[model samples]
Target: MSIAIIGPAEIEAMIDREVADYPTDTRAGAQTLEAFQNARRKPRLVSVNFSGGITQKCYSVTRPNGDYRVIYLPLAGYFSLCVESDFGPLDIGVHGPAIACFGSV
Candidate 1:
């Protein structure tokens, strides 16, 4: 099945809000924002997984702080965010589609 990314505007806006926590004038913050923008422009497809005949595509963006994974569940038309940190992967939350996708998945 072909994988499609959903809600680019919402995704970009959310990422922008998250990045806004850092002061724009700070070097680290600026670098982080730049990395995020670059990733949004050309996200790297990290993997494709199939479970119960359902396919999911994972795309990742490298940031100064951590890596962000955008997982697309095409069947459900849902997208979820996973952030990598020193501790481990944290589920930022699900975006796009609706909460019904969560129950079904």
Candidate 2:
């Protein structure tokens, strides 16, 4: 939805919630949250809606309002940003001591 439609207050609330949900103890967390807030302030791209449920390989998943795949990066000390992907949770990447799986969520 457009920021005009959601209004400034709602958008700020969303950004605040995202920032609050993440621990800012790590550099990655701070940078991620900063970039996220900056992007929201100057949104440059339309959001894409990925289709289909996850078919295989998911570190973690959630469905608060929409499906999200999350994976904690132990070294990085925080979970990767929850994202909707063309490959679902498989798109988190193939490197690192990642949590692996072979089922739909």
Structural similarity to truth (TM-score) of each candidate: 0.33, 0.30
Q: Which residue pairs collide in model 1, if any?
A: none
Lowest lDDT 10-mer window, candidate 2?
96-105
lDDT for each residue of candidate 2 in 1-105, tens digit (9 for 90 to 100): 322234334434543565577666989657755544443332111222223542322223222124433343322323333455543433443332211111122
Best candidate, TM-score-wise?
1
Estimate, for each residue in 1-105, the C-alpha lDDT of model 1 and write its tens digit: 774545545544544565556456978657655554554543344444342443344444332234554544334455555556554334455555221212122
- Against the true structure, candidate 1 has what lDDT? 0.45
- Pairing residues by index, what is the TM-score of model 2? 0.30
Total backbone collisions, model 1 = 0
Badly placed stretches (over 4 Å) of model 1 are 1-6, 42-47, 50-54, 57-105
Whole-model lDDT values for every prediction? 0.45, 0.36
| Structural RMSD, model 2 | 13.1
Clashing pairs in 2: none
